[model samples]
Target: MQLNAREETPVVSVWMITYNHEKFIRQSIESVLMQKTNFPIELVIGEDCSTDGTRKIIEELEQKYPQVIKPVYHKSNVGAARNAYEFCLPKLKGKYVACLEGDDYWMDPFKLQKQVDFLEANPDYILSFHDCKVVDRDNKVLKEGRLAENFKKDLPQESIILGSLIPTNTVLFRNRVITCPKEIFSVTNNDTFLFALLGQHGKAKFSNDVQPSAYRVHDGGIWSSIDNLEKRKSGLNTYEQLYKVIDSKYKHLIKKALFTRRLMLIKQNKSVLDSIKYYINSYNYFYFGNGMYKTWLKSHYDLLKQLYRN
Candidate 1:
């Protein structure tokens, strides 16, 4: 006798937040529409008063596929983080949430189905992500795939504090906890905070698929447009502030990551004197003292390679 096989119900929502993305919003939306899944899925888009024709396209798409596209058009720009937390995310009705920005798109038609299947089978895992390809403003493939080595299948919350291991567009997470705390709004890295929050409930999984989404790099990108020096400084300051708000046990890991970022910034500036100053400042902490000196010395070889590549 054959046992009965039951199908899972539709329980996924795709949230897209966009501003001035007329150039790429269509592709992003189409990618979600192209997804093949047995369960029902909704695409909730928040268009933040885009000065470009982004809103026009969104409206047209909504008309054509009113059943699938749920749009929120704002009169004034409330910013991405605020728009998502305050207006967009809370309205989602799915048991699970997948995110994509207007500028980035999923490459796999089964992207949502694959991630949803994973989470449904593994109840302990709060989130799942996959590798992505990096593309330049012109759509040239800068890198075939971003993940150089395979990450652990399941990563703990504290382990992810060092940096963002998962790309924003590639993540699919449970909607068990949707609201962001008021304090988190003060911090600049909302994705990190969101992922960290999910991690606390359970571990995050990296899908075996190496090609899922294409991460776009352009002048308008919030973080990508900043110079390396300023970006590193901003990163350090952000982590310091984040440490104050996060769980006490994760503070040590955050501090260590900040020191690593500081050293990288110092090296990138190509100033031996800056390195000397950093070394002096780090003397107060034994962990950062002599070890950093050796690390700095070893970094020069990689620096030369970067120079040649550029």
Candidate 2:
């Protein structure tokens, strides 16, 4: 039976999660509104009680595009994860949910059409995402392409668990991909954890045809609130916590990935003693064949250097 794309129902829902994004809310909303698709699409904005004028802008847009723009306005500032699991996820009425942060915008007008078509054509794939350009606060292109080189390749569930391979703003996933499990509430890196869960259900792909979206990297970002070192450390902890809740097969993969991340973080450290301390804590979760010996020696040398300096 040949499936007709035009005959497909309007079941694609775009979820926009925002908090105090007055600066970029308009552009984000406009981008969603600009999508050209044959099927009907609804935009659900999860406004997390913005102190800035972001809520006002959303209210105005909702009034103008009442049929297209549906917003869940919170009274207080709940964190992004809660706002998503509690407020946003429940309101989703579409068969597939596409996510775009309030600060990010789609570069291509056919973004939604392309992604929805892919999902309809490829039923095995649980999630379909594309490359995204990283931009700064001023909308200047900081990175012309995707953040990771491997992002363009077709990615499996394991790859998603090992690292963040999918660009958030460019993702269009099945509505059933997420269940809002309580265990993930504490995860600092929600995207990676959620992606892992989604991956378990089916495969994920980085669509080559879909137009790229613009992902803003700025100080105001939730992840940007902490430094790189802290974020990585927090991510490692999140992965460990996830290991307990996830299936056994994914447990080793998370630890192995965190082990590699710990190595990178260790190299970034200036003090040898600090590196040794980091490794000592890391030993509880990971083991690398001969690399472990080398790290041990380097850590000892650093400890010696600290002793000598004193």
Q: Pick the candidate with the highest lDDT.
A: 2
**Model 1 residue-pair collision total:** 0
- The list of candidate 1 runs beyond 4 A from truth reads 1-10, 150-154, 259-310
Error of 2 at 165 (Å): 3.1
TM-score of each: 0.80, 0.85
lDDT for each residue of candidate 1 in 168-234, tens digit (9 for 90 to 100): 8988899976677775677667777677666667778898763558899987889777776776666
Off by over 4 Å in 2: 1-10, 148-150, 270-274, 288-310
Per-residue lDDT of 25-113 in model 2, one digit per residue for the tens? 99999998888877777888999999899999998988787777889989888888888887788777888899999999998888777
TM-score of 1: 0.80
